[model samples]
Target chain A: MQTNISVDLGGTNVRCALVDENGTILSIVKGSSNPEKGAQAIVDKIESLIKQLDNYEQANAIGIVVPGLIDQEKGIITAANNLPKLIDYPLKKQLEQDLGKPVILANDVKAAAYGEAISGAGKEHAIVYYISISTGIGGAAVIDQKLLSGFHGFAGEVGNVIVDPHYEAIGIMNAGAAEALGSGTAIIRIGKEKLGQQIEHAGNVFDLAKQNQKEAQEIVEQMTDHLSTLLSTIALVIDPSIIILGGGVMKGKDVFLEALDQKFHAKIFDAMRDIRIEEAQLEEPGIVGAAMLAQQSVSH
Target chain B: MQTNISVDLGGTNVRCALVDENGTILSIVKGSSNPEKGAQAIVDKIESLIKQLDNYEQANAIGIVVPGLIDQEKGIITAANNLPKLIDYPLKKQLEQDLGKPVILANDVKAAAYGEAISGAGKEHAIVYYISISTGIGGAAVIDQKLLSGFHGFAGEVGNVIVDPHYEAIGIMNAGAAEALGSGTAIIRIGKEKLGQQIEHAGNVFDLAKQNQKEAQEIVEQMTDHLSTLLSTIALVIDPSIIILGGGVMKGKDVFLEALDQKFHAKIFDAMRDIRIEEAQLEEPGIVGAAMLAQQSVSH
Candidate 1:
């Protein structure tokens, strides 16, 4: 019956939830992160948001998930793009001091992977790799019920892996990065360039591909092929029991799923060819995973 | 104080050694695998080789490391090209019965990585990735003192990862595979094709590159660049504490080390830019690693 507070700290907003031991959210609260104001201000806002919950004081622990590099052992945000001020900031210590409770901090994607590994589509699998093909691709891996945070908590950054060395670079990402080739933003950009018109999102390209438009189909095929390359590389290296695919780009999965599966199977090593690729089941893996971490932390 | 038997099963030879608990080889025995003769014949040769050792009965356990796919849990060589007759053969069970001792099984590269992780350059780090850029590139990852054997034990098959979609395919490897670009075999093949002369080995290309030969330098640069891509992909995905580079390619490392490091650093993610890449230290990691696994099996 114990409760824990879970917070999904994003660049634009902070989502707080009071979740029980079983990962059920008893209550929820949300507020603007106001990143332009700075890190401490956002922390203060998170505090205020949590205060809105009637049972905040009763929670045994608090978990916070954030985008960007995190020093898990030190509970510091090492490098956050949107919340740059939080770099090397001891967010967990600050939150613990204010909340008067234990705190667990992790990368947002890793937390989501843990959530999926514990109770979602990957629950039955011992090794789970969760990839979110959203605005930009991101990934996380959970092995034996624990997230594999490499030397600096950077494990499972699969999107950064190059799929084509000749492709144009996107922002900080290198040329031919899986993100630049397969992510939602990449799809839309390629779609616009090919159609000679404005395309609002990746779904438009998927729709065109489904209609058998040559240019759109080629673009979609490239995207899926690059994604397959990334997936096969992951399979060759990690060979997880299951890979759970999610994120906004998957909304139009019907157009690419079968093609992706075929391409991935074709490229993967013989020994790892059988790994199942499935869709992520949890709707709020971030919040639930944060809560799961909090619960596990307290139990340990 | 106790000893274990280690066997390195390759396509060309069967190497057996009696190693102490600390991985010190107390006695050695080697023999031709005569692979074309069949699996049982190879097994018999291996057994006879072990019997030739004076410490055969004194060994507590046995560890076998193989090149192709292995069912480690069941101790079977599922599909080995050289030992095709061993397909689905219960090598571990048979070895245990013949040796009258416990047995452990693992992939050769994985065993080498475990050996390095336990006592080589990677001993200082918790996560270690060992890559052997030899005739055909191969890789293995050790996390927390254990090799990461994926669902079907295909973890760390990095050479199969495609680096270029447009490149010509080599043998069973897909087009643009890291193996096709960076492996020692690839270097020789490309050197002969470009030089229009019979280049004996990869060393000739390095020797030419060191002398600032344009074509040779280009070939070496391409190899190093592809290696950098592979290493960067590994860093982004696994973010190991340290990466250990080994195999025949390292013999010509002086020609490519600095350039490889630069290329790898340039492509790796910002958070993972500091990962240290080092050389493999173990002189006989295969035998030592097999022995280590043997000792661990009994201890477990």
Candidate 2:
């Protein structure tokens, strides 16, 4: 079986792993993707990680997943919020030259979704929606065994959909987006303001909710309402065979999931009452997805 | 050139036309779709109209468009709000048997989008989003030269996306949705209550706004804001090559378009500023789109 090197490149960290054709990780490695050191430093870090996974004869392809607006067809990072220097970078070409192997690049979320669809929780389903509710809410769709990439390669942008028209004028943008209400970033922002120095991270906030913190509970309830509304809308539109929810916030939050399911059911129309919503089953979904995408592209 | 008979079935009337390979209507006809009489009566009306276009020797296919959730693969109308008896009806099989030719059935809005993408405003565009702002805001998407029908065949439910989380409990569920704010149904309801019963249609409401009626202007302004936010969200997510706006409400309302463009530009991210937004140019876009869908499906 062919193997591939998958790299999940974020501003803070670059996670590298040797993944078999079946999406099993043989060995793992890591490095820093420090943008302050400039684009070349980031490229060098990726190259060093590839060297660390030195089974050159075994690996046939390299897949790199990054954040932001990417032109997958051109293998270029158009504009990334996290890595500003990566704008218009010909990542595929640079990586290929550095590693001397066939390389594929995609948006991090899209890669994660493809990974989930092929080998994770979405493996058994024909149509799946993979959503990441972390610092930001990101999503991707796999329909009829193909990723639904729209004209400009910006499909599955569920996070930007407006949820409040009246609030548009108040500079309160992204109110309808899942990221604005349910993301870890949103939770932390609200927590800091409501609980001040009492809460540091979203995980701590969730812990507070678990311990019956009124403010924490209030934020969690608001998050549930936003998530339920977003999921209900997705259900009505896509009616996917399965919805796979993942990210840091969803890892061990069973209570949040239960509340979200109840709210989602109440809002959905009768016709779409039977849709299945579940948690993704992958330790490093993004890395696995990036590897799978590389293998699939090379084979095709 | 081969010809096909396309029928647009609505609650009030039925419009039929003989369309050639180039999407030209050779002959046109019309009749009533009186649901009070029953489903069989509506079928008979359709058959009679096809007979009027008596060049059956040249016709090779039959296409029917209706307002409802359609099971495209089975060629069945799963549920039609207006024609309630159409539930679980094998519309294509029955029509094929009656006409002695292949028959195709599709959702009216999907057909309209097909027409726009193939020959109207969205011609040659790889990604096209067609939105019908009539009684309700219905939308459809064409991606990678194919329609995006989700797992349950209800993919283009754009109107269901939440627009307002707070207002969802009362006035209208999901206030951020375009249908909740910009649809003809919403307009009529809000118009009658605020501007009196004199403003019956969307056009009349626009005329009232031109006359500087405060309530009428407010309604149009609010509707524009809603439309702009929805369009911006779509742009941020899909980044379609072009957005084609159609339906009865947009026929003569130029001011609404201007306002919508302004709001959309203001809200969309800088990277997605180059997308084209245009008015649809198909005459009876829905009927033509249905015909195109039928032909495309049969050929495939």
Candidate 3:
């Protein structure tokens, strides 16, 4: 019966909601986070946004999900480009004091994974791995409805996973990182090279490929192979009951989903070829999962 | 207060031991399993070995660890190349009935990971990942002492994980599998081609490298770089507190461990640079882990 106020905090906007046990948002308020206004102002804006929730007072705890790395054990945002000024700030402690309630902070992807594992596509499975392919790629594993919080809250940072040691090297990331080779950013980058045009978005590449453009189709196939290698490698390591795919890349799922599945199965041992990869079912998994994470943490 | 019988069943030998609460081997016996003599013969051999233990009747349960795939949920050995005849046998039920105790079967790498996490090099860590570089590479992740058993029992089959989509291809494994690139078999394979000699063992290559053989050193470096890529990729996926290395390849640890660590750190994000890689500290992790698994399962 526990209820929670979940906030999906991103650079551009933040959504505060009151969530019930079934991951339904009971009441919600949304507004620009304006992280550029600096730490204290953004924090105050979040507090006001929470107060605007129709059933805010009924919430048992607050859970804020962020898009960047968090020093979870220390209750600080270690690195976030949008909220740079808040980096290393005692966000958890500061928010808890102002709200007068227990608070939980989780990585956005991890929270989404937890949400899906408990109430969405992964509800029937005990081991669920969630992968998000957007401008960049990220992932999280939810085992028995609990997120795999790595030693430093890096358990699901699969975007940086190296797919090949010899292929391509980008700044900071090693050559052939999954994010470098298969993410939305990678699609656009590869698209420009092959099509000799300013390909603005990954969707365009998918559309072109769907329209039977040989160049775009090659890029899509390249991305598919890169993802297949990454997924197959992760599957070997963790062996999730199911892997749920979400993110901007899923917009192109119709173009690449079947190919991705076939390529993934071809890479792993036959016994593991059955590990299902499906599109995420929740429309607002980040907020819902944040709420579930708070509810679970407080109840336990 | 619980005690159990742990059996490390390999194609070559079987070691049975009475394990006490602290993972101590109270009593032990070892001999060839003679798997070729057939499934029933091996089963009989195991039962006889258990009987040879000083306190066989005191065990509350039995845990057997095998090298190949298992249908852990069904308690069946699904595929073990060495014991081909026992592929679909009801090994767990047969053993339980014969020994009159509850039985649990686990993959060897997974059991070794449990052993290390429970009482060996990884005892102090909550998330322990074990990677063994033997004839082929295998790995397992033990989070809070429980192995991450995949949908089937293929969770720790890292050897078959493809490292690159375009590297050299082998039999059933996809092109550029971790085993094909970095295992002892790979080392010997690469050494033979470069040094123009039948390199009998990976250790000989390491020995020659130590003696300043240029071709051998290059092979060692190649293997080291492949391992670094593999480990760095894995670190991003799971972010374990500690990674314990075992298997026959560790015999050449002096030649490659330091370089492997340096290369591994170089490839990962700065935040994960501190993750430790250490040699496994168990003389017999297979038997010890199998025992701990039985003890934990029954108590739960």
Q: How do the residues B1-300 of candidate 2 rate in per-residue lDDT, one tens digit apiece?
A: 878779998888888898887777788899988977877888888888889986964777888998887887788888788888767777788788888988888788888988888878888798888888888777877875577676767666777666654444324344445577778877887898898888688777888888888888999998887778777766655668799998888865665888888778777655566678899998877777777777777788
Q: How well is candidate 2 docked (DockQ)?
A: 0.50
Docking quality category of candidate 3 according to DockQ thresholds: medium
Q: Candidate 2 regions off by >4 Å?
A: A31-48, A51-55, A58-60, A80-86, A98-100, A165-177, B34-37, B51-60, B168-177
Ranking by lDDT: 3, 1, 2
Q: Which residue pairs clash within candidate 2?
A: A163-A176, A163-B163, B163-B176, B163-B177, B164-B176
* Model 2 root-mean-square deviation: 3.0
Better of 1 and 3 by DockQ: 3
lDDT of 3 by residue, A107-196 (tens): 888888899899899999988899999988889888877789888778878888888766668777778899999999899888988886
For candidate 1, the per-residue lDDT at B229 reads 91
Q: Please, what is the whole-model Cα lDDT of each candidate in the order they appear?
A: 0.86, 0.79, 0.87
**Candidate that would win on DockQ:** 3
Per-model TM values vs. the true structure:
0.93, 0.91, 0.96
lDDT of 2 at B178: 59
Off by over 4 Å in 3: none
**What lDDT does candidate 1 reach at residue B286?**
82
lDDT per residue, candidate 2, A1-300, as tens digits?
789889888889987899998889988988778888888888988888878885845897988888877877788888788899888878888888777888888788888898898889999888898888887787888876567676667666777665543333223345445666677887887899898876768988888889998988998888888888778766655668788998888854765999998888777655666678889898888899888888877787
Ranking of candidates on DockQ, top first: 3, 1, 2
